[model samples]
Target: MAIRDWPEGERPREKLLTLGAAALSDAELLAIFLRVGVKGRSAVDLARDLLSSFGGLRQLLEADRQRFCAEHGLGEAKFVQLQATLELSRRHLGSLLERDAALTSPTLVRRFLSAQLRHLDHEAFAALFLDTQHRVIRFEILSEGTLDSASVYPREVARRALARNAGAVIFAHNHPSGVAEPSDADRRITERLREALALFDIRVLDHFVIGDGEVISFAERGWL
Candidate 1:
């Protein structure tokens, strides 16, 4: 049966409107994005099939254009729409960071950083430059490397911090290997960066190591 044929309270859109988006299943949220289904399937049914074929929602969202477009019930238009939606979500999270003190909103900071870096197949090193009041001055991906490691230079990081006139910075890097534990190299480099930036009166607030579903913080572990 079509989505419209379902009881009003049972409908994906109606249920979202009534209970809230968090109340919906992954398939239901995706069905709302799909808007309509092909041939005999309802939108929710098509969404479930797509999610299964893609190996779940994250895999589907991270799929390349060709792979995503090749799926049944999806094409260029849907790819464009999906990319736009993902970017909008990232920007919204970034905007929230810009408006708040980075230190005070550690959860938001982790979320924003996770959204920015977690999808990459390769490793990336990023920095969040903060003003005197600890508001975000800029967020930048300093370098990207192979799946295992990214080369981070203290001179380059210092240059950017000076350029941004940052009073403090929070460093982050992703382990594509999905291990949030900070390697010894991670600690050494963070210490080097902290020392280098201190010469310019800039503080290194924290270093975060992002994994698949976990984020490890240097400050939280009293490493800083």
Candidate 2:
């Protein structure tokens, strides 16, 4: 049956309005984005098929424009809409981080960084500059590199910290290897950055290594 023919309580849109977005299944959430279905399939069924084809919601969202547009029932417009929605979520998270002390919401910090970096095919290093009150001031990608490594310059990081007039910073980098374990090089780089920033009286709050399924924190492990 068409979604319009379904009981109001059972429909994705109605359920989202009556219950909450979190109460919906992954397929239902995606169905809302999809808006409509092709031929005889319901929107939920179409979303389920897309998720299966792409291996899941994350993979589907991360798909390249060409790849995504080529999918049945999806086109350039949907791809554009999806990309916009993803960016809006990122900005919303950043705004929330800017309102609170960075360390006070460690889980939110991890989630924001993970969403920003986990899908990258290469290594990238970013810094979140914070004010004296620990509210985020700026987030920037300091360096980008190949799959295995990225060359991070302590001097550049220090300069950016000074430029932002930041009092503290949280460092983050993604491991394309899908392993969150801190390598010796990772430790060494963090120390170099910490020392360089210390010269300007700036503090290194924490360093995070983002992986596919885990985010390893230096402070949590007592490495900082």
Candidate 3:
């Protein structure tokens, strides 16, 4: 049956309106995005099928243009819509970070950085430059390539920190491999950055290695 044929309270849109977006299931949320069904299936049914085919919402959202467009109910338009939505969420997180002091809001920092970095296909190194009070001065991508220890330059990091007049910094890098475990190379690089920044009397507050689901922090592990 079509979604309209369902009982109003049972329908995805109605349920969302009555309760809240948080109350909706993944399939229900996706059904709202889909908005219409094809041929014989209801929107919810198509959403369920897509979720199953793609393995979940995250996988579907992260899917590349060609792979996403190849899906039965989705196409380039939907892919574009999804990407725009994702970017908006990332920017929202960034705005939140901008409004708050970075050190006082560790969880928010992790969430913002995780959302920004987790979906990248290639490794990226970023810095959250902070003022003396630990308020964020600027967030910048210092380098982009295969994220290994050797690829990130300590001098470049120092230069950027100096350029921003940052009193301290929180470094972050993504592991495209989805493993949050900090490798020995990761530790070595963190130490090197700490030493380089130390010469200018700047502190290396933390180094976060962003992985699939978890962010590992050198400071949290007492490795800093």
Query: What are the lDDT figures for the candidates, one per model?
Result: 0.93, 0.91, 0.91
Candidate 1 clashes between residue pairs 3 or more apart in a chain or in different chains: none
Across 5-33, the per-residue lDDT of candidate 1 in tens digits comes to 99999999999999999999999999999
Per-residue accuracy of model 2 over 1-224 as CA lDDT, tens digit each: 99999999999999999999999999999999999999999999999999999999888988999999999999999999999999999999988888899989999999999989998888899999999889999999988984222488888889899999999999999998899898988888898889899999999999999997999999999988
My TM-score estimates for the predictions, one after another, are: 0.96, 0.96, 0.96
lDDT of 3 by residue, 202-221 (tens): 99999999998989998999
Score candidate 3 by TM-score against the native: 0.96
- Model 1, runs deviating above 4 Å: 146-150
For model 2, which pairs clash?
A: none
| Candidate No. with top lDDT | 1
Candidate 3 local lDDT, residue 2: 87
Candidate 2 residue runs with Cα over 4 Å from true position: 147-150
